[model samples]
Target: MKLISWNVNGLRAVVKKDFAEIFKELDADVFSIQETKLQEGQIDLELAGYHQYFFYAQKKGYSGTAVFTKQEPISFKQGLDIEEFDDEGRTITLEFPDFYLINSYTPNSQPKLKRIDYRMRYDDALRAYMLKLSADKPVVLCGDLNVAHEEIDLKNPKSNHKNPGFSDQERNKFTELLDSGFIDSFRSLHPDEAKYSWWSYRFNARKNNAGWRIDYFVVSQNGKDLISNADILNDVYGSDHCPIELDLDIKGE
Candidate 1:
C-alpha cells in the first residue's frame, strides 16, 4: 500500500495552490496531513475516492491533523488519551485490519527554547503510547516530527546544534523513540540520501537548498521487512515542508 504524509503548513492556503491537482498526481491509498491550522467549516475538500478524518486543535487556527484514506479503517482514535497533549490536536491513530497508523504533528520548541519542556514531555508520552500500541500490532507512524535526529538530517548541523529543532535534547528523544522498536523508513531505505523535507522560509533557504529532514515515516521494527520504498517529494511546492511517502507490501497478516 502507498501512504504519504505532509505538513501542509496551512490547508486553506495550499488548496488554492493546486493542492487538489497534486493530490491526484500522488494517488496514494492513504494521505495524511499535519499542521492544518484550521477549524470546522473553514474550508471544504472534495476527495472523490477517500474517506476523510480530521482532528482539529481546540485553539483556533493552530496545530491540527487529518487523514484521507481510500480504505476504511477498522477503528480511529484522535489523541493519546492525555488531556495535556490532546489539546493541541496533534495526533490521529487508525487501526487497520493488520496494523495501526499513527499520524502526528509534533510540537516545536520556540525560539528561546520556551516550549522545550513541553515538547520533551510530549515525546515521553507519545513514545509510551506508541509502545503500548505496538504490543497489539505493527505501527506506521508518520508526519512532521519537528526534529533533525542527526547531523545527516540537516544541511548545517554544526550551526544548528543549539537551535530549537536541532537541540541535543530533542535529538535524543528521537533517538530514544527509534531505540524503542521503531525504524525511520526513509533513512533505512536510502541511508546515504541527503535531501530534506523541510526548509526555512527565512533567508531564501529553500532556494539555497538549506533544509532539514524533520518529516518521517517510522514503522515498528517488526514491520521493517514489509517496507518497499520511502521517498521525499522535494520538488513539490506550496508549503515550506514537502511530502514524505512510504510504500509497504503487506499480506494482511
Candidate 2:
C-alpha cells in the first residue's frame, strides 16, 4: 500500500496552485494531509476514486487535517478523545482490517515558545493514544509533527536551537514517543541523508533547500517490517512543505 502525507500549509491556496494535477500525479493509496486551514463545506474536491475525510478545528481557518483513501476503512474517528486537543481538530484515526492509521497535525509551540506548555501536553496525549492503539494492533502514524528530532533533521540546528520546533523539550518529547515502541520510518532507512520535508516560506528557504525534516511516517515497532519504502518527495511543490511517501507491504483486506 502506498501512503503519503503532506502539510499543504493551506488547502485552498494549494488547490489554486493546481493541487488536483499534483494529487493525480502522486496517486497515493492513502493521502494524509495536515494544516488544511479550512472548515467543513469550505471546498469540494472531485477526487473520483478517493474517499475524503476531514476534521476541522473549532476556530475558523486555523488548524485542520484530512485523509483521502482509495479503500474504505472499517471505522474512523476524529480527535484524541481529549476535549481541549479535539478543539483544534488535529487528528483522525482510521481502522482497517489489519491496522489503525492515525493522521496528525501536531501543534506548534509558537514563537518564543509561547505555547510550549500546550504543545507538550499535545505530544504526551498523542503518544498515549498511539500506545493505546498499538496495544491492540499495529499503528501507522503520519503527518507534520512540528518538531525536528535531531541535529541532522534541520539545515541549521545550531542557529535554530531552542526555537519553537527545535527546542530541547520538543525534541525530547519526540524521543519519548519513539522510545515507546515506534519507528521513524524515513530516518530508519535514510539515516544520514539530509533530505528535509518542511521549509520556511520566508528568506527563500525552499529555494535554498534550507528545511526541516518534521513530517513523518511513524510505525509501531510491531509493524516495522511492514514498511517497504519511505522517501521525501522534495521535487513536488504546492506548499512550504513537501510530500512524504511511505509504502507498506500490507493491505486493507
When superposed on Cα atoms, how far off is each prediction in RMSD?
1.2, 1.1
The per-model lDDT (C-alpha) reads 0.93, 0.94
Model 1, 1-253: lDDT tens digits are 9999999999999998989999999999899999999998898889998999999999999999999999999999999898988999999999987789999999999898999999999999989988999999899999999999989999999988879899989999999999999999999888888989999899999999999999999999878787999999999999999999999897862
Runs of candidate 2 with Cα error greater than 4 angstroms are 251-253
Per-residue lDDT of candidate 2, residues 199-249 (tens digit): 898999999999999999999999988999999999999898999999999
In model 2, residue pairs whose N, Cα or C atoms come closer than 3 Å (at least 3 residues apart or on different chains), thus clashing, are none
Q: Single out the weakest 10-residue window by summed lDDT for candidate 1.
A: 244-253
